[model samples]
Target: MTQSPYVLVLFYSRHGSVSEMAKHIARGINKVNGMEAMIRQVPDVSDTTKMASPALPENGSPYCTLEELAGCSGLAIGSPSYFGSMAAPLKHFIDQTSTLWMTGQLIDKPACGFTSASTMHGGQEQCIHSMMTPLLHHGMLWLGLPYKNKELISTQSGGTPYGASHLANSTYEISLTSDEKVLCEAQGKRLAETALKLKK
Candidate 1:
């Protein structure tokens, strides 16, 4: 029998807000029986240094690779919003995945995105959709939260059709609202189940 595929949860977090959302998604991915979740983070980008990054991260999740993107059954990408767009560091990482896109390795795989911002009106949907563009170009199946997720429609905090999101205040105190958490878990579980079905 073909082995179940792993759903890779890739993201970049500056203030740990987006990292919190990634964890919620991983929690949902873990609910599936056969599928697995792998969490990874990308290194920061800098103008001064194009030489290379350290072999190991100082702390937090390890660096991601194109191999991980190619091997995974599905992808969950997250980023913090920077003026209605994904942060520069996350964009830098995604830009490097063109090699996988060129090989069609990500084709037919299911993918989704999420984001966190420092305000209720901080362009959550825009940020998530921003990350979706490259994945769509890679020919991956895009997964979105359905309206049936009641928390999505009723959320006074942060939740949307694009994906999952959280609202952070000035202090960057990011908490996944109940609605945000539910939607994130739902997104992860949905991706895992879909990956299994596709594998079959």
Candidate 2:
């Protein structure tokens, strides 16, 4: 049977913030009529990752397969900020997509990024850009929240034109503020709308 069209929500979370954002994004994608969201997580990586990390996670979504990734009509990538860039484990998974790139599998697909940071100024925009570069290399069309989204102006915590974001530690916890969550949902909705338009 043919699979229904879905926007792959692929992400990595360390403190659970990014994963939560993926859920919100998926909710937004499901708002579209003919599109859906496929949530997946990348495996953790360490110096001894291959032998040290389990093939399956102890909880949450399973590791993303190349087949799921290549089949998606759209993508929403999320990661936690590490210094001023994406977390290493997510970066490692992105690096492995060379095979997909060579085959042009993701070309013309709509993609967006979201991120979480431990602080208000923890390089959130830069981290989102780090995720965007690889998607650009894969020939995917990128999407970002526009100024038209009122939350982009009223947000006191985290949300950016580059993509959805969250101040993961505002309450000494990993919750997204109201405005941040709104933007995330808006980004997902927009990505879904764009992907459906392009697929035509």
Candidate 3:
């Protein structure tokens, strides 16, 4: 049996906002026929000495593997905003993909980014751009939400042409707004469609 083409929805979240966004993205990916979404997460990094995280997370998505990253038809990476950049854990995982970069395993694959920040001005766009750097080095095609989405023009919370994003408020209490959710799903569908077209 042939395996279905899948988009790897990879992300890291500290307070669950980004994780929830991943689910909505996956929903949109699945809406595309002949495509599937493979949601994965990276393990947290330690500030001190390197200590291994458990083989599996205590809950939620399993940790992503390099093999899975290489095999995906498309990619969507999400991370929480950390000082206008992606979180350390997700960046650490991306750093491990040098082998994939050397082999050109990710070259030409469509990829997009997403991020959630704790404040309206909490560096959401910056985080998305920061995440794109590694993907660009891997030679993947960068994708961003277009103004055609309409949400990009009207959303005061988190939609951006750079990618999908959400504002969690200072206390991480704000949920994804209707516009933000639409943009997230639209980004996923757009990525899936692009991947499928490229495969042909």
Candidate 4:
């Protein structure tokens, strides 16, 4: 049987905010017929040594593989903010994709980014851009949420034309705002639509 086309919803969430946003994005991706969402996460990296992560995480999403990353019809990558950039774990995973870049396996695929931060101004946009840079290097078409989503104009919390974002606050207790959810779904839908159009 033929495999279904999938949008890889790849993310790393230390406090769970980015993971929640990824679910919303997957919901949006599923809204497009003939497409599916594959949610994956990267393993945490330790500073002490280059110890390998466990084969599977104790809970949450499974670790992403380079093969999976290269095979996706589209991609929605997310990472929690770490000093105005993507978290170390996610960046570590992206760094291993040089082989994919060399082979042009990811070229022309549609991609988008998402991020969550502990504060409203905790550099969410920069984190999204940080995630996009590698995709751009791999020759993927980077996509952003358009202002047409409406949430981009009115969201005081985390929606941006650069990508969907979330403000989890210092306590990390906040759930996604309605505007954030809308924009995430919109980003996923737009990516799926674009990927489908390109496939034809």
Give the TM-scores of the predictions, in the order they appear: 0.93, 0.96, 0.96, 0.96
| Per-residue C-alpha lDDT of model 4 across residues 1-200, encoded as one tens digit per residue | 86689999999888889999999999999999988999999998889535357889999888999989988999999998888999888888888888998999999999999998888888989888888888999999999987889888888888888999998757476499999999999999999999999899
In the range 1-200, model 3's lDDT, one tens digit per residue, is 86689999999988888999999999999999989999999998789625357888999999999999999999999998888999888988898898999999999999999999877788988999999988898899999998899989998888889999998766566479999899999999999999999999
Whole-model lDDT values for every prediction: 0.87, 0.91, 0.91, 0.90
Supply candidate 4's per-residue lDDT for 145.
Answer: 85
Q: Provide backbone clash counts, one per model.
A: 0, 0, 0, 0
Point out the worst 10-residue segment of candidate 1 by lDDT: 46-55
lDDT of 1 by residue, 106-182 (tens): 89999999988878888888898899898899999999999989998788887888898888766378777888899
- CA displacement after TM-score superposition, residue 192 of candidate 1 (Å): 0.7
Residue lDDT tens for model 2, 73-176 = 99999998888799888888888899999999999999999998878889999999999999999999999999999999998888999999998654347777
Cα deviation in Å at residue 55, candidate 2? 1.5
Clashing pairs in 2: none
Query: 2 or 4, which is superior by lDDT?
Result: 2
Report the candidate with higher lDDT, 1 versus 4.
4
Model 2: per-residue Cα lDDT at residue 66 = 90
How far residue 59's Cα lies from its native spot in candidate 1, in Å, is 1.8
